[model samples]
Every structure is written in C-alpha cells, then in structure tokens.
Target: MTRLTETARGVYVIAATPFTDSGEIDFDSCDRMVDFYLDAGATGLTVLGIMGEAPKLTTDESSTIVARILKRVNGRVPVVVGASAPGFAQMQDLTRRVMDAGAAGVMVAPPGSLRTDDQIVTYYTQVAEFLGDTPFVVQDFPLTTGVQMAVPALARIFNSLPTAVCLKHEDWPGLAKITALRKDGTLNRRISILCGNGGVFLPEEMERGADGAMTGFAYPEMMVSVVEHHAKGDMERARDLFDAYLPLARMEQQPGAGLAIRKYIMFRRGIIASPAQRKPGANLDALSRAEIDTLMARLDRRLKELA
Candidate 1:
C-alpha cells in the first residue's frame, strides 16, 4: 500500500482520458499522456477526474484508467484516482481496486442523485471508512455535482475523517471558505487545499494561501510554468500567465467543449493522435470549429509574443 503521508503539492494536472478510434480505452495513449505531464513538471496527477470524463466512464473503464496511470507513473509521484460512483458499494469497490492498483490516494465527489448536505457528508464518511488507511480528497465541484458543501458541513466532515488529506475546492467562494477555515484554526494544518476550477483562479487562490491547483488544460508546460513561477516568488508573472490564458481556460470549461479544445491544442502541440474523441463528445461542429480556430490562432500569436 502507498504511504498515507505521500502528500502532493503544486500544480497537478488532471489528465483528459484518451479514447481509441475504435472507442475503446487507449491504454498506450494514457501511458504517454502520463509521461508527458510528469516531464512537464506536474506535482502529481489526478486521473479519472472531471476532465477525465469520470461520469461517462464505466466502472471497469475507470479501474483500467487508474491502473494505466499507476503503471506509467511507477510511484514517481502520487496519483489521485477518482472514485465517484453513484452508489456507495460501487464507490467503495472502485476505491479498493484503485488502491490495490497502486494509486497513492483517491478523490471522490458527493454521490450522484443524492442532494442533502447530510447525505453528502455521510456518503463520504462511509466511503472513507471503507478505504481504511488510504488518503481521500473531498472533491467539491458545484457545477457538476449539483450541490455544494457548506463551510459547516465541510468542517464536520473534515473533523470526522483522519484519512481526509485534502479538499479539491472548485468553487471560488468555497475556496475562500476553506482558506478561512485554515486561518481560523478550524481546519487542520496538515490538510491541503487544491484549487480545482481549471487553474482559472489558481493565482488568486495561491495568493489567498491555497496549496496548489489541479487543472487538465495545462498538459505540457504552461501549468508547470505557472506553479514554478509562483514557487519562485514571481506572483506577478504567475498571475499574468493565468489571466492571459483566461480565454483558453473558458473554452476548456464549456461542457462538450473542454476536452475538445484541450485535445486540439494538444494536437497542435503534436501530443495526441488526432484529438478525435468518441461519439457524443467529439469536437464542435463546423461553425464552432471555425470560432475555436480563430481563438486558437489569436492565442497562439499572443503566446509567441510573450515568448
């Protein structure tokens, strides 16, 4: 079993799940992607996260993705595998398999089709218990989860779990609340807060005392650059990079839009096979592609200017 104290920090890239032309899981591409991000200097990787299309993947598929990542990483850095199952039993089972597959930790969101804050807390608590000694990251993405964890609820949940290592705070205000919790001595000093919202507010969160960010868009370098800059005390440069890439970031946030845009950029960078996603989540139509091309061209020119 991976050590419980194998904590990660800085800009970790949550990778986009690669699919083969035949619509099967592309294990080879997954391995390459893992190596690509690690060499780019990601603090770690969170596979099967929202960017990995966790909701759309089957149970076996999720397990396979985590296994591929672990094999590629070889424990060089911690890997947080997503185990957000709609039901408790399935979530627990996935968590066990991921841990068995060599994931350093598991990141889980509140259960699907379940609303109440109490239910969310209870679900996570039980899931944490099932995992025993593994580290758990409470994923808070209000946009996808349809429910947000209030400060008090979060406090209660954190207070209850010894294995809860971090909070993937996706909500800006919620991140603020998390910072507040730490400041006020409510949150344990050991627990880290990883910024989630696609690195959009990373600079701000870092300034406000967030530990790091988890964004899939920064596959190759810019993500590493941002964190490295910040770590070196170049807050101005880091924030500038974050704001300058806001358009690209927004494009990545649009549902049915995020992966496609990232994949195209990766293709332009010569990373992926063709940026061809399987049916139902492929690139935008002709007009949408035209607009993306225009934006991408502008961004590429601007990036060159900065270089």
Candidate 2:
C-alpha cells in the first residue's frame, strides 16, 4: 500500500506536464515542477489533473508521470493522480496501474461523453473495488464530464466506498450542494473538500466551508499566504493577496491557455524549462503572449514589493 500522509488543506498545485520539442513527456521538467510546488508549501502535487492536461495524455504517459512523481515525492505528502477516461475498464485498469506504481491516491471523474448517472456511479464503483480500499477523490468537472454530480449521486458513491477521502469540487452551482451536504450532515465525517477551480473562487468557497483549493500555476508562497492568513484570522490580508493575484489567474486561465499558459507563467517566474506545450492547438497569438508578459511582469514586481 502507498502510505498517505494527511495532506493539509491548502492550495495544492496541479503540476503541469512539460513536453519536449519532439512531443514527448519531459520527466526532467516534470520533476522541477513538482519541486516548485513542494518548495511553495503546497499541500501536495496533483499530477495529470485537468490543469495537467489529463485528457490529452496517453495512459502510459499518465502512469509514468505518477510513478516519477511518487518517487520524487518520497511520501512527503499525498500525490493524487488522475485516472479518468471514457471507459470504466480503462479507468479501473489505470487506477490499479498507478496505485501499483506507488501513487498515494487517485482522482477520477465521470467517464467523458457519458451522461448517465448510473454509468458514472457504476464506473466509480468498479474502479473503487479494483483499487481495494485506496483513497480516491471524486473530481467534479461538469463542463467536461457532461454529468452534474447531484447530491444523491455523491451520497450513493461515498456510501459505497467507505475509503473515499476527498472531493475535487468543481461543479459551480453544485458547489452549494456539497456545502449543503456538510451543513446538513449528509456527507461522511472523514471526507475533506478541495477546491479545483483554478483558485478563482477559493476565498468565497473557503468562507462557505471548503477545506482547501487545488490550483494550477500557483506561486506557493502567495497561495499558502492567502490560506494561512485566513486561518490566522486575518481575512483582510488574505483578501488583499487574493485580489493582487486575480489578474494573473485570469490571464493564465483563458480557455485554450490551460496548462500551456501555466507553464509559460512558471517559465516567466524562472521556475521551469521552456513553456513549450506537448500538443498543438495551444499556440498563443501575439496578443495573448503580450498580455501574459505584461501581467506576469506586474505580478512579479508586486511580489517583490510585498516581500
């Protein structure tokens, strides 16, 4: 069994997958990104998440990344790997593979292109059984999963898998549903909620009772600062830091920009290798590039001022 430390509720960085010019998974750069998040004091590193381009990556690549991250992390914190796919069998196999490769936990979503609630539950049920009580995070990405995770479904799945530990809460309107579950005593007592929506609404969600956030393109210090300050009862300072970084979040989160833009910002921040994306169609035009550059420069200067 992969030993899992209790990951503190904070901004866990979705470590972006870097690619070589020849279109290969860059393990060297992937390690660097993991280290960056660790040094930033992230609760953990979520590899192959949406921000990590989970959908586009191949199964081999996903398992390889999980294995490498597991080795690099060395049980310091939870390493959650994505095992989502369209087929239940594939996801089950992927989950088992990643676990065998030493992942501390796995995060999965409803199979892509399948909207049936029964199918979603069945898929998760099968994956959970195969994984044999391993901790899992239910990743709610309605924008892509096509199935909104209603409260009933969440309850049913969690009831079935007693070991389900976390929820990667992404469904917006449904976010309230989760909070309702917690408020009304419907969810399991051990289940912790993590925000996976790019940290845009994290403060609001935190106020609403979320455990922590899973953000991509995170500068660990500021991310941790916001959460820690709030935990320290300094809501004003937390809000101030949140506002200061809002522009950078908006710039890097443009639809197609996803992980590519995250990599670019990390490069601009001098934390990674080239910002080259593994696949095409992520090419940013001059306007987007200049916008990112300007925003990053301003954000960097602000960081210095804050320091």
Candidate 3:
C-alpha cells in the first residue's frame, strides 16, 4: 500500500463531497474536484473527513466515493480516508474496503465520549489492533471531538503504535501541543504533524514545527503557497499570502454553515458543478452569499498586491 510517513509534508487537502441539487452523489464533480486539488499543488488528498460530510453518506455511498477518488488520484498522491466509527467492527470493515480500493492511509478521531488521557490511549490502542498494519492519522481536534488528548497520552500512543504515522492536529489554540511533541524525546517515533483548524493557525503551527496543513479551505492554493514559503524560510511572504486569504478562510469556517460556504466557493470557482450538500445541511442565504462574494473579491485584490 502507499503508506503515509513522517517525511510527508505540504498541503494534504481535505476533500469535500460533491452532490447534485437533488442530493445524489455527483460522481462527475468528484473527478473534477480531485483534478482541481492536484493542479492547485496539493501533495496529497484526504477524503471522507468531517468536512467531507462522511456521516451524511451511507455505507454504499462512502465506498463508491472512495473508490471513485482513488481511481481519479491513481497514485499521483497519497489518499487518506477517514475511518472513524463508533464500533471497531464498522471501522475495520470500512478501513479494509478503502485500503483494498487503494487508499494510502486512514484517519481516526477520538469518539466524543473519550475524556481522560487513559481513555484516549486505550481507544487508539484498540484502533491500532483493529487496523492491523494500516497506517492511520491521529486526529486531535478537541473542539469537535470533545476528547482532549494530552501530550503524555499522545506520546504513549506514538510510542506504542507503529502504524500511527501522522496527526491531523486541530486542537484550538493548540500550538503548544505541536511545540511539545516536536521537543526532543517527546515521541518515541517521528510522525508527520499536519495542522487542521481550517488552516487558520497554519503559520503559527509551522513555526512550532508542524509539517504542514491537512485542512479544508476553499482556496487550497493559499495553504500550498504558505507551506512552501514557510519551508523556504520566507516568513514574511508566507504571512502575506496567509493574510490575503484569512478573511475568506474565516468565513468558510463557520461551525454550522462552513461547508455550505466552501461548496459555494468551489462551485463559483468551477471546481464543482453545484454547491449542494445532502439533506440536513444548510444552504447560504443571499446575505451570506453576498458577503462571500465581497470577501472573495477582496481576496483577489490582496493576492494581486502580493504578486
């Protein structure tokens, strides 16, 4: 399999699931979206993520989407599938299906019920057993998962599980965690640390030793450029580019309405044909749409100035 490892860096775009106006999975748009991400300089692709609207899809739909994406990617870059489920049996089954379909790896977030450090470690230990050699990413975004994994607990997970290869670190204001993990002797093994708070904290996270970003922002080129500039030690250039996109990024990250905003942008950009989400998802109103249009226009102007 195409396994992810410590050396993996640069933007691994969290993909959005495309749907028709009638709520059917838009397979055609899926192909277009994959191509768009690669052309925008994504080093890898992560699908079925929180923002990918994974839970909104049925098991058959999930498998079909992953299969479609893997075929489109065709090994150009690694594809990581989110395999987090309430039960290990479901998680394992999903992992096997995706891996068999040629996914590079899987990502798992702690269930919302996990509270203490021990509980987090125990959960991952079970995850490692269930996965059985499939490389996985530890998604530590307490704001959404409601499970706070402290540094020591994470250290133990990294030390114990050989297959845990990366982190989608999205702990809000969690720059300190990145600093702590990168400190010498903190983790038994080195793993790629990718920040994922909508790339809002990417600049600080990189400064604190994060490899890059693995988040969903409408304009992934912004993330790609920021990570590249940071790697070249051009902090000023990185910050300039990040700042140019920050307004739109922040707007696209609204808790209940973020995905709608993102899909609207993608549709406006022609990456996807429609801005539709499955049932139970909100669609942007005229006011929200107008605001996004304004931000995007400003983003264009700022990018031109930077150039």
Candidate 4:
C-alpha cells in the first residue's frame, strides 16, 4: 500500500458514493468513477467523506465500497478514507478495516462540540493513540465542523502526533492560516496541506502554500491542471484555467445544493448512472438543473477558447 505521508500532493479527488434510483449502492458506477478520476490525473482518492454520503451507509456497505474502490485503484495511487465518527470505537474500527484492506490512510475531523484549543489538540491526541501507527489526515473544515482551530492549535496536533501526516485544510478565509503554517518553526515538522471547498480558492491556496486540493468538484481535471501548471511556474496558464472553471466552481459551492449539482453534472457527463441523493438529502429542481446546464455549456466554450 502507498501510505499517505507528509509528501503527499496533487489532487486527491474526494470520491462520491453512487446510488441507484432506488437507493441501492451503484457498484458499477463506483468503478467507472474511479477510472475517470485516475484518468483525469488525480494523484489520490478520498472516499466516504461528507460529499460521499458516508453517514447514510451501513457499516457493511461502507467497507464494501472502500474495498471495491481500492481493488479498482489497484495501488495506482494512495486512497484515504474518511473515518470521522461520533466515537473512537467506531472510528478505530473503520480505520482498522480500511487500512487492512489497503487504504493509504484515513481522515478525521474535529467534532462540532469541541470549543477550545486544548480540546481540539486533546481530541486528536487521543485519535492518534487509538489508531496507533495508522497514518491519518486532520480535516480542519471549520465551516462544517464549527470548531475554529488556530494555526497554533493545528500545529500542536501535528507536532505532537507523529501519525498525523496531512491536513485537509477547509477553513473559509483561511489563506493566511496556510501562510502561517508554512512559516519557519510554526510546526515542529512539515505535513501536507491540501485545501478543500470545491477548489474554488485553489489557485490562491496554492499561492498561500497548499500542496493541492482534496475536494469533490465535478471537474477533477481542472484542479489537476492548475496544480501542474503552478508547479511548472506557469501562473498565467494556471489562473486562466482556474478562471474558466470559476463560475461552475462557485455554483458547486452552494450550501445544501452543491452535491446535487455535482452529481447531476457527473451524470450528464456520463461518469455516473444516477444523480439522485439518498433520502433525507437535497436534489436539484428543474430550474436549477437548467441553470447548471447553461453553466456547463459556457465552461466548455471557455475551455476551447483557451485552447
């Protein structure tokens, strides 16, 4: 297994869980999605994240999907599973299962109840202890978790936890925080910093010292291109590509409707079989779907013009 480490970089496309119209797991679509991501230049894959509808799956279903994707990936790239849960036992169990099944690592998020620096650091300390020797990613998504962790607090987690190897940085208005973390001596040792939020701010995050994106935007190729161009010192091309996708990227960042829009686009692009979310989730109305159609058409024209 290619375990995720501090050196990990590039787009780790957060894989979405595909479901049939009747709400059954669409394993065939899952396989095709995996192929699409790899061909799109994703360096790694993260499954069972918030966008993956993880909380909706049974324990058996989650394991099966991870195993299936890992099998499909066949060690082509590192695969990180989102193992965040309400309790350590659940988290530990999932971590062990996926790691043993050849997952590169797992990601854990701070629960919303955590409200202090010590609480945040202490929580991750216990996580590192429970999943002894298993590499993990610290998902600092304050927008979703509601736990505001300053750079110092996150540095404390990384400095203290040898197993914490990467940060899924999703703090809104968080570019300065990235600059802070990249400063000398701010962290005891370096760890990978991959931004989230659908890659809307990816170009800026790269400028602020992020390695790459760990997001679930429908266009993984755009993130891949931006990172590749930036790494090659071609900022003009990077920004041009980023600008072309900005409208759709902004549209996909909507609060409740983002996932629906993403799935619908993937379905339209023939990457998935169904665009339906599971029950108790959001779906796009006809007007919203039409709007997305218009945006995608414009994006295609923009890309060709750039070419």
Candidate 1, which segments miss by more than 4 Å at Cα?
1-7, 112-116, 172-175, 218-220
Number of the top-ranking candidate, with TM-score as the measure: 4
- Compute each candidate's TM-score over C-alphas: 0.90, 0.90, 0.99, 0.99
The residue-by-residue lDDT of candidate 2 on 131-220, one tens digit each, is 676788888878766777777777778767765777788876555766675766575554677876677776777777777877675565
Indicate the residue-level lDDT of 213 in model 4. 96
The candidate, 3 or 4, that scores higher on TM-score is 4
Order by lDDT, highest first = 4, 3, 1, 2
Q: Count clashing residue pairs per candidate.
A: 0, 0, 0, 0
lDDT of each: 0.75, 0.74, 0.92, 0.95
Misplaced by over 4 Å in model 4 are none
Q: How many backbone clashes are present in model 3?
A: 0
Candidate 3 least-lDDT 10 residues: 1-10
Q: Candidate 1 has which clashing residue pairs, if any?
A: none
Instruction: Give the Cα error of residue 298 in candidate 4, in Å.
Output: 0.7
Q: Tens-digit lDDT track for model 1 on 1-307?
A: 4543425578668888877766777777777788788888887888888777777788888888788788889988888888777676887889889888888788888755657778877877888777788888888888877877787778778878878878888875564675666776676545777887777767777777777887687443666667778889998787666666778777777776778888777766656666777666765677867776787787777777777
What are the per-model C-alpha RMSD values against the true structure?
Answer: 2.3, 2.3, 0.8, 0.6
